[model samples]
Structures are given as structure tokens and as C-alpha cells.
Target: MLRRTFSLLAAASVLALTACGSGSPSSTGGTAQGGAAGGGDLTKVSVGVIPIVDCAPVYLGNKLGFFKDEGLQLDIQTATGGAAIVPGVVSGSFDFAFSNLISVMVARDKGLDLKFVANGASTTGEKGKDVGGVVVPAGSPIKSAKDLAGKTVSVNNLSNIGDTSIKSAIEKDGGDPSSVKFVEVAFPDAPAAIANKQVDAAWILEPFMSKALADGGTVVSWNFVDVSPKLDIAGYFTKADTIMNKPELTQKFTRAMNKSLEYAQAHPQEVRDIVGTYTKIDEAARSKMTLTHWTVTFDKDAFKTLGDAAAKYGTLSKAPNAGDLLP
Candidate 1:
């Protein structure tokens, strides 16, 4: 019933970004206009998103008409997973997207002409926060990552942050991460697999991590830092070409984002309600939620951390002068 109510409210509240995007091809909104083919008169912009609480600000902005006030009609496309959204956004299928910082840097290093314009959030607290615990069904006795050699481990996305985290957790405990078989599952569906014993362990994000815990699953361990200690978590990005070609539009977009982020920090509960509108989780569970930190502030450390990760993972063919990519 809450989902139904929230859905109806979401439908009524979200003002499409298309309704306010610049109608003129020449009215560069804020930044320097790029030299590519002129973006035609169209207020509607498709934004790519993944299903997670970090994206709550966008949801709140939609619910509160923030984008509309900024003259952008956003047509949000919830991605099935993080892997696809980066390419989709770069290819123009989406104007901007919420994606893992590592993927964006890897894509940028690969010459995708990407731009990191905003920060979604970072893992906070002394224990670190981006990576989540590795879970096993209640009392399975697979007490450590090392014990799971040759066992199957499921992650929300294959070879992404979840995989990276799982690898870290395994190696920390004297386990050979490569020996384990990795599987992919979405955030919302992981708990059922645990209940049915579909896999030995599930490496997941928070909130979902909370759900796995709530279900009586045993959590082995997790490392919450940026894949590297000083790394950034999630961020919003766009094609470099897009920013170069449409500076004004990009600025307006950033402005709206800044407002929404500030509001998110001020009202976490409202943000959760906005998140619940999309996730199928019940209201009671949603109310007990803890979302990660969100920031619109973009900086060099974030890029360097991402660049370093790419270099370490061989995602970069050659050492990149990370500063070359920053604003």
C-alpha cells in the first residue's frame, strides 16, 4: 500500500526535465558551448540512474520540481545495473548518469571524454563505508572469506565495486579471491537468493546490507574505504563533449544538483521516503535507513583516486596525468 501511494505521488510530483530544458539551440545556459552538432531545441533530457539510496537527491528534486525550476525536463531511466549506464550516458542515450566513480574514470581513461561534474556521496564513519559485508545464510559456518575457496559469491554487479570489495575482504583474510566463483545479482533480489541458499555469500551495498542482516544472515566482514583508502564513492558524470558543447545547460544542471544535495543533507528522512517510492521495500524498513554522504562538490582527490584505481586495475593503458582530466 505504501508503494502504491508513493508511486502515485511520484507520478504526480515528478516534473519531467524535458518540460524546462532550454528550448533554444543557441542559448548556452552557463558553461562554454561545445563545437559538436548543435543540441536541438528540446527541454527533455534522459538521465540514467541505478537503484540505490545515493540517488535520493535526484528523486527528491524530481518530486519537488527542482529540475523544472531550473528549466530541465529530466526523463529518468533507471538502469538495470551500473555497467550499462556509463556507456549509455556517453553515447547520448542519457545526458548524465549516476555511476560508480571507478567506472567513470576507467571510461575516461579509455578515451570516452567523460566529465565528473557532481558528487553523489562518500562512505563516512571511522570504519569506512562504500563496501558492505559478505553474507551467508543463517548459521552456515562459512565464517571467513578464506573458508569460501571455490565457493560461489554473488555481487550486485559483476567486476564492479562489489567485486573489488569482495576481493579485498578475501585477501585480507588470507584467502585467494580468484579461487572463488563470482556471480551477479541486483540489490533488491539478493536477499531471496540467500533465503533459498542460491549462493554461498552475497557481497552487497548498505541498506541492502541492512536487509541481509535483518533476514538473520551472518555477515563475515567488509572494508568501507574508497577501494583505496582515499577514494571517492559514487558521483554524477557526463560526456566531456556534452559539457564542452553545452556549458550553460551543464551549469544549470549543476546548480539544481547543488540545491538538491544541500536539501538531502538537511532532510534524510524525506530523502528515504523518496527512495521508498521506487524501491519495493516497506515503509518501516525505509524509515530505519541510513544513506551515505552526498556532495555536489567536485574535486581533484576524487579524480586522482579514481585514476589510481584505473592504473592499478590495468584499466588505463598508460599512466594518465590525472590532472589533465579535471576542470
Candidate 2:
């Protein structure tokens, strides 16, 4: 099971520009506190989605009519860039989005108003919560972690999980983490790049990594969690004002999302089948992957973990301690 956070690391490439299906709620329906049992005319909302395994809930919710049940017509757009969700959600082109926590936390530095109301997942299962991996070509003889020096390592984003994961690996093995070069590459591109020897090794995540190995890419060290056990991950706000003013909507969205998440928790194979429809990966690739569990409540401990890591790494501009992020 793969537990992916945000970044183009999780989705398509053109999400830098976003679109939504925003309109007033359908005249025939309205969603209330009783669960989506009797919603009338629906409000069409543009929600951002990326084509990754983690977003199975969003896709599944659509298939299951969870949004419509709640009088929401979710128009999901797959994202393409790391920092684009901020502009898109704030601009109102997207009513809500399934994006990583970094994009929003990074915005706090710029003084944007937003909030993360739910916890997505922590890596679990034998897949072991490891979401990223550093791999080399097969039979390349690059045995030790030190051999990564002077070699270009590709990541889906800069200073993100892919990079941080590798950073921890480098330091643990007596390698100068900063000395190794990191190139910004997407999840799918990593396979071809590494196969063609475009880069010595790449920090990548599922399906694609599965593909690279199938094509004979050697595994140098695929254990990304062993590299860094940081909260370098999470989903961000649907809208700043929604979190601030329409708290009900925020909670409603969370509830609906958890409904889908609950279904996913009980049905893993169904999740792969659902996510497979959206991702480029095939059945074999999907079957080989591990997954993370989805939960609804946003525990303070997790946010604290994220704040501490950000402060330690200077990822936050104001050095927001855990208190700043808590409600």
C-alpha cells in the first residue's frame, strides 16, 4: 500500500494551472447534518485531484456518489505541479483539492489563510509506510551509499519527501547529503531517466518504481521510510475561508471523505482496482504495491511532528512551532 503526500510527486504535470466546476448548489438539493441521505439540488464544486494511488478515496467517492449524496458535484482536476494548489484553491477555480500539506504550510510563510482538517495516513503494512525509494540500475556495481556522490539523483520535488528521504539515507552512510546533486523529476519520468542512465539513481514512489524494476532497474536502497521518518506529508485545505467561516462545509467534506476512506479501509483490493483506473499502473504493478490507511481525525501530535521537522529543516519561514498550527 502506498501512502503519498502532495507535490507533482503525486499527480500529473499541468496542475500548475487549475480548473473547477464551481456553481451554486443545485436548486433541487441541499446537504445537511443528517448525512447525505436526502440531498436536493447540488452545488457543483471543482475539486483538484492527482492521478496517484492515495487519491483513491476521491475517485471512489465520485463513483459512490458521496459528493452528490451531500449535494456536492465535485469536479476533480488532476494536479501537475508542487506549489500550484495554493493559487488554484485561493483563486476559487477549485473549490476543494486533495493536495499535500507542504503546499499549504509553505503558504503560511507567505501569510495565506488555510487549514488542514484531516489526517490522510501514515505508511503502514509490509510496504512499511515507505513511500519513496532510491534506486540504481541493475548490475551497476554502485554498492555503498557513498557511491551516490557526484551522481545525479532525481526527485519529484525539491526539499520534499523524495529529497529528504534520500538526505537521511546519505547522512546515515557517511555520505555528504548536500554533495549529492538532486534533479527535479516526476514519478513517471524517474523510470525512463534511470533506465537510460540519465541519472545515476532516483528517489521514486510506486507503480512507476515497480515499472523500473520490471525493466531491470537495480535496487540500491528502496526503503524511503528508513531514510526519513518525517511528517513531510498530508492533505491541505479546500479553501481558507471555508476553514475559517464555513467550518460546517469543511467538516462536511471531511465526513464525506472519511466515508470513502472507511470503505477503502475495509476493502484493499477494491482500492487498488479503483486507483488503478486513475493511475497509469496496471494490475500487476498495483498488486505489488503496499498501501497506507486513511483516518479522519487530525491529531495534534501529527501536526506537531510536521512543525518540528519543518522548523528543524528551515522549511517554515516564520519557524512556526506546533502551537501556531493547532486550532
Candidate 3:
């Protein structure tokens, strides 16, 4: 069921990007100007985002006229994962994109010149009740992060936030972090993988996490919270050239996105409702799933801790310079 939903979302994302046309933004840094509800010409811009609950704010903000108020019309394209979204932004197929901080850091480490414009999601800092967690089967002997040593774990992406954070959590728990093996498994497919005993543990996020727990999966560690209470997981980012060449456009987007983040943080039910419009998560799972902490402020200290952990785990070549990365 989960695989089917992701397939549909991936197909829609491809079609949306194709329809928008790559590298079609005008000289003024917008695709085209169209009359908005506020009786003004709005610069239409494309934003690449994932189809997860993390991206609910962008959809809610658009519905609430936040983007229109900023003299912008958003062409929100959905990607199945951040990997696809990054390339779209770099190639100008998307004016901006949402991604986890680790992925953004890895891009900068590789000299991609990306800068975060607005915060996306953060850990709730509540162990055993965070937005995401590493889970083991109900009867499994693995009881804590330390037990995960030498066990195969599933993550949505390798060398990104999942494995890096889990390694940090394990090391903090007195486990041999280097001994833990990681395998790539999409979020939707993770529950089944755990149920089938294909993996000893799996790091999963909202909607899917709820499903895993329902299927008798036990949370061994809330990796994000275990890493750092102030950790900012993901945010909206764009190429550095976008900021330089189109300062006005960049500022407008940042302001609108900040407003969206603030709004989503304040209105929880609205965030749940909006998730259904973009993804296949039903109302039951939506209400039960843990929501991520949405904020406009990026936590530099938390980022430093995460980056240092990433570098130590070899996910990054070196600790990322938060001062240069965060706008």
C-alpha cells in the first residue's frame, strides 16, 4: 500500500516538473507574472518538495494566501525524496527546494554552493515521542541504542541524516557506532522490512512510524532527540547564485516561508488536514502521527553538533560551517 502511494507521488512529481519546463525562469527570476487574488502581478516560482508530512506547511501557506501576499505564486512540485529535489534546484528546474540539513551540508561539502533560506522541520526533543525514531521488532532482544551495534539498520538514505544521527545516538549509548551496518530502505517500505525481519532495525518518520508502531515495532531510540534537543532537521534552500542574482525574489520567498513555518507551528490541526491534499496518508494515520516542530529560526549550536557527528561518522568530509551555510 505504501509503495503504491509513493509510486503515484513520484509520477506526479515528474509530470509537474515536465510541465513547468526546466530553466524557464525569466530575467527577473520568475517563470511568469500572473494576476493574483490581491489584484497585483505575482511572480510565479517553482518549489521542489517531498511528499512527506514535513512539507505540510508549504501547502498550508499556499492555501492560506501567504505566498500571494508576498507577490508570489508557488508551483509546488512533489518529489518522492530529497535526492531528486536537490538536483532540480541546482539545475534551475526548481527555484527552491526543501531538504534535510545533512543533505544540504553534504552538498556544500561537495562544493555545490547551496544556502538555506528558511527552516523546515526540527526534532521535538521528546525521547520516545519524537517525529522520527529507530525501531526494532516487539520481541527483538535489542533494547537500546548500544544493542544496535553490529546490527543492520535501514534508513531512507545512506550517508545522510538517518545513519549519521543513529551512529551518534549509538556512540552516546556506549555502542560501537562503526560496527553498525546501514542499508537503504524507503520510508514506506520500512515497516514491511521490519515486519519481515529483513532488517534488525529501521529509522522511520511520521505516518510510517505510526504504522510501524501499530505493527508491534518498538522504538529503541529517538535519534534526532538523542543527537540534540535543538537539532533543526531540514529547511528550504536554493543555489547561492539565486540569492545573489535575485535578492528581491530570495527575500520574498524567505519571508513567505518563515510566515508559513510560524503558521504551521501554531496550527496543528490545519497541518494534519493539509497533508492529505498532497500525500496519500489517510486521516486516521494523519491524526495519530507525531508532528515535527516547525519554526522560522535555525539553531546554529544544534547544527554544529550534528555536523560534527556527521564528520566523525564519515558522512561528511569535515564539519560544516554553519555560519556560511545558514542564511
RMSD of each predicted structure = 9.0, 5.6, 4.6
Best-to-worst ranking by TM-score: 3, 2, 1
TM-scores of all models? 0.75, 0.78, 0.91
Winning candidate number (lDDT): 3
C-alpha RMSD of candidate 3 = 4.6
Candidate with top TM-score is 3
Which stretches in model 1 have alpha-carbon errors above 4 Å? 1-43, 126-131, 142-150, 172-174, 226-231, 298-327
Model 1 C-alpha lDDT per residue in residues 141-208, reported as the tens digit of each score: 78877777788888765545556555665666787767888887766678878878899888767677
- Candidate 3 lDDT over 1-327, as tens digits, reads 012012334543554457344344333365455646445567888888888888989999999989888888888876666566666666676788899998788877767788999999999988977999999988999999999999999998888899999999999999999999899898999999999999999999988998999999999989999999989999999989989999999999999999999999999999999999988889998999999999899989999999999899887889999987899
Between candidates 2 and 3, the one scoring higher on lDDT is 3
Poorest lDDT segment (10 consecutive residues) of candidate 2: 20-29
The lDDT per prediction is 0.64, 0.61, 0.85
- Which digits, one per residue and each the tens of the lDDT, describe model 2 over residues 209-318? 77777788766654344433433355635545667766666666767777887777788888889976776777887888766556665555545555445445545554
